[model samples]
Target: MSKVQKPEKSDKIDNIVGMLMEYEKMTVDLMRKATDTPILEQYDLNAPYAKARIIKEDGQIKYRIDEVTLTDEEKKKLKEIGELLIEELDVDIKRLGSNENAAAYIRKLVERIIKNYKIKLTTDSLDRLMYYVIRDFVHFDKIDPLMRDPWIEDISCNGFGIPIYIWHRKHESIPTNVIFQTAEELDKFTLKLAYMTGRAISIAQPVLDATLPDGSRVQMTYEKEVTRRGSTFTIRKFRERPLTCTDLIIYNTLSAEIAAWYWYVIEKQASVLVVGGTASGKTTTINTLAMFIKPNAKIVSIEDTSEIQLPHENWLSSVVRTGFGVSGSISEITLFDLLKNAMRQRPEYIIVGEVRGSEAYTLMQAIATGHGGLATLHADSAEAAIHRLESEPMNIPRPLIPTIDAIGVQTRVQVGEKSVRRMVNVAEVVGLDPTTKDVLTNDVFKWNPKNDTYVFYGRSYVLENIMKRHGYKHEEVMEELNNRRMVLEWMVRNNIRDFKDVVEVIRTYYVNPQQLLERVKREKMEAPSGGSRPA
Candidate 1:
């Protein structure tokens, strides 16, 4: 009835314009809410900023990380906002509990700045801005993505203007597009790394060897003091979940039989040493084998940088500390000191991250004293490991060297256009020859490169000793080994590679072998035929 009188055309137009303006405002508000959420919480924003792919260049396989391009205007805006945020922000990133929390806090701060300045930014632009801000503030900066990449094992920057090199798990070492364009930029980044590790680096203290919060090992040199080319840094990314025996088997690093053998000897309290060249996975092997120790055993691990991750509840991890003041004035704790201290702790097992300097002698002594010792050494073969033990710095006597019950030699080799790690040889330290005073080793497992298969030598002195110690007959020991091999194989087939899950299976076996074995057999029979064996 009231609409009998028609409204003016100008009024109708004004009403339509107001509705359009309100709709636009509502859309903008919704977009702001979505963008303001922590990038870590957003599935789309959480995707890896960069991806790596294998490309053929010059008839050779190459690893390439896709580069992200930003417009000049975007970069200019990013720099301005980054400087302002750094100047105004007062939060200590380390105390933020986790990367997620840090990201959320930084996002809130960024939103505050945006609102205060009334800066107009699209949702996509805001996402990019938040990612970079969180990355620079919470992670390793330019190398953060490299660190986040699970395939990258190592990252090395020689100096400024040099491309960073990354050791891809698949491609081995390859150069990356990321580089520090100037000496000052590299120096600043190196200092930031040192700061992240809670260590100081300067002209006075030019060297920094420390463990990052995420357990990665970082070594840095400051300001051309120790390094000739400005500043340099190397990061050895640590595996958050240590490799399990099942994982090694799946990777073909070793045969299931070798893993079973390790399980048997390690359970019998036999000492072991993993030997390999740099980046050949010595520490990884040690970590995997160390999982075989009894769950309740008292274990003490000493290291310069904490790299070993064990599931044992009774484990004590000790790291060497560099003292303040002068080198001689303030006594610095060394591996030898920690080893001696660990000896006093009455631990059943002593794990040395690596045997170097006088610590090797102490480790051998601990092994000779009947303390189960597990360590890693820089050597390519069992014989070389023995030689290094007998040489200076180690100086482990010939008789004491036999206390090391097993030596696992790991090597990186090229196989059909790919680089892989393999346990080339696993030898048991039988004894020292009385006449020649030479260490006698019995090869238990050898890797055959022809077909990339591992050959069981059919004899293991360590297993024999384990059988004797446990009062098991030859047939019984053989059966036990076979059962363990089957269990490991089943795990590989079933994809039970998580460290905790693997350990649970192992502990279950230790508690009730028959139960676990029966379950494994049932599952193996039910599994698909194609998945019965590891690739």
Candidate 2:
């Protein structure tokens, strides 16, 4: 990859590090406007220095400009002249001090002065010209394939000795050639990120974890204490536009029919758990499912790395801090601690990004409190998911498992040309075996690898049990399922999905079925699209 070379710091103190990048741009523009600043008449890329000539007040001299040194007087003159030149051409005065504040760097400049026997510009003036040449250089221009990368979910560095690795959407994890020039530079960057988050990362606190200004989660271990390298940092990039449920439908990640039934459950305030292997789209699934929640419902989401994004305004997002053992401050609340506090907040719904440790017990206790909760977990199969919940670390008792509304096991299978990933099993916990502890999950839909399709064992038995709990007749339950499935299919067909309409239908249907169904019929009469109105 060709790196787009740029100055590390701009002269515009608004640039970064109290420097001024804009001043450079203004100078170039002035030079360009004054005499149409001529490009070097002779140029060579391979060599750092090539024959380039410029007219100074003294005269002209052939020399490579970038490496030239100037006396104090000439430096002051460069600053004076550059300022006057840039002011002639207007530039955005506001953005001149954005990142590191480049304005502080305007101390001096190089100027052409009278020389022996004649007026001519030498290497000193040429240095000034070269500095003005490329002031618009945005920091990190050269290795931007790694910086501005769209799919890079994570950027990590173990220290100055190793290359950076990025987690891309399609490429998964790939190493980049970007390297810090020194260990001190790497440490400064880590401290900067911690500083941005109002946290500290230093040798006194060898380990540092905090969120960057751009919302990327960062963690760094300093010197040989934590790792063999001097210092290493990892940045988990947050998605700019997270994939919504509609995107899932279009991507074939899940079927519209299943999504429709789930919408009904969500509006009913069903507690759900999403299970998947690493990189199996677990977090995305949690984020997409959050859309089904009632718009006004109060939601509190806790995470070690902030990942879940809800469209609702009534939501609180929190992340855990770790102990400063590795080198930094060890002042972070445990997930268990956050969960206890969340209970007091009385959130209508509680979301844990990924559950581990004692928090599982309190989170389960919250579920028993009648608050709707949504979370994701790492497990291969539905049974495995249950075991992980009931086993040692999580230790969620088997009896309490009934409080969970559904266990969604997302899986991937190879289908000829490419690997196809899907929400293979959406199992409902009707009732567990009293004696044997084994969960009796009715896998509603299973992928048939041979045909490269799914076997939708239509009309979930799970729906029947839940409907009975609500005092609905068998016929009423079946009719409601078909009704929702229709809206879902229509959403898939007409691309009229946003989940808000679907959730409204579910809520209305659950609280009062007759009024909403009747409205759907009456609205269908004058419907312009010829499809059912989920409203």
Candidate 3:
């Protein structure tokens, strides 16, 4: 008998490919069945896969999937489809004008490719392929879903071959399923992102900072030469409608009473500084409190990136421009320069997004001249905020720190397994303490972590100042505050939390306080006596 011939190398490879295809089919079927479960529908797949088991490892609660992956064959097919579509379309996705247009075009193009190729794929597999294709071409690549998730505070990629991490609104920081597996891929992706920001990256300039098309702030490191890792990028997603005072109340970030007090204080033209560290809700708090300013006032807001959204027609928003050289000047304009120019514009309320560097001095001087400034600062507490102003970079005189009439501390703290943002403290800058050479502040609101609530510690000196300035009696002030509180509660109860609706209510309060209050109270009383509202 003739010896049996050994299987050819190509035959073995073909056998392996056939096995992978079978595996891919099984995987697709299982995924479809898994997704069809009722529980999975309620839990958004993009939101950290909430239904999965969460393990406590490395000081974080990480959601883990034991077994779920794409086979090499599936990945190869996806790559082939993507390339074919790009070749056939020959159109720049960025120039597609709107996401809706791009999405429509992509859907039709993908369907055509599927029909022509006659590929054997399940409905679920086709859907998955379409998502990846749209992500890579029409959106932010692998992190597109995370970018669209409103609850995601941040999207951070450490480096090539590393898993991406995200800061979820509920979960603090969790690892994601997305990754950039190669240096060339990440380098090219960052360059594309930089282009979206109207900037460029290269060996000469390995660092890039930009604001994306959707207003999110992006910072990226080009290559391994600049970053120890291959490449990295972080995106701080922007909120279309920055949280309003009523939203803070609804979220329990602050109490209705505290919001009312701030409303009165802002109405009286008192300056305020919201203090907190990184990822704290300082900007959110200030942007919300800004709604308290009179709608007709001439408000000038200055910042490096445009984050504040105001409904006032008289508002002038200004953003600082970076210079041509790294930290150098070509046609550069700084926050300090904007503040100086704002002074000339005779703005009734001056809003500085953050007080970093010497701009603090000009802001304080503006506040001293009764400009009614509102700003945010990075600090742990009220005292630290004052110290930051008086210290090196800021160098505002000790006496001028008091010009900031109120300090609101926004703290992002871990409450059990969930991360929650709360206004931990609100203090009125009474005056300077002669004995201790410190900024004297009267603590008005303090957070009780045990109860997970904010409690009033003392009467607000800012409120008293407002009362005296407006020539309103103590009872009158208290009555006005109670009326405002009632309206706020009604809004929260009825879920009138949109920024525009909140602004409309506030504006109505200014034009016709009694009318608006009566309408709100009527709506509240007509509703059932008891209804569940978010805490």
Best by TM-score: 1
Please state every model's RMSD to the true fold in angstroms.
11.4, 15.9, 6.9
The parts of candidate 3 lying over 4 Å away from their true place are 1-93, 103-131, 434-436
lDDT of 2: 0.66
Across 184-257, the per-residue lDDT of candidate 1 in tens digits comes to: 99988988898888888888888889988899999888887878898998999988888899889988999998
Candidate 1: residue 159 lDDT (0-100)? 94
Give per-residue CA lDDT, model 3, range 248-274, as digits (tens): 887789999999988988888889899
> Which candidate order results from sorting by lDDT in descending order?
1, 3, 2
RMSD of 1: 11.4
Cα lDDT computed for each candidate against the true fold: 0.85, 0.66, 0.83
In terms of TM-score, which candidate is stronger, 1 or 2? 1
lDDT of 2 by residue, 1-535 (tens): 9998765445444456334566778888887675743432333321342222222222321122223345676666556555554554334323555434432232121122222214345664654544432232212222333444554677778778576776655434555545777887776666555655667666677776676555566777876677887888777776677765566776667876677667767766778898988768888888888877877889999998777777678999888877655533357588888888899998999999888678988988898888888988999887888888888888988888878888888866555645556888888776677788666777777766566455777666657766776887878766766776655554455455554554454456557867765665665565577554232
Selected candidate, larger lDDT, 1 vs 3:
1
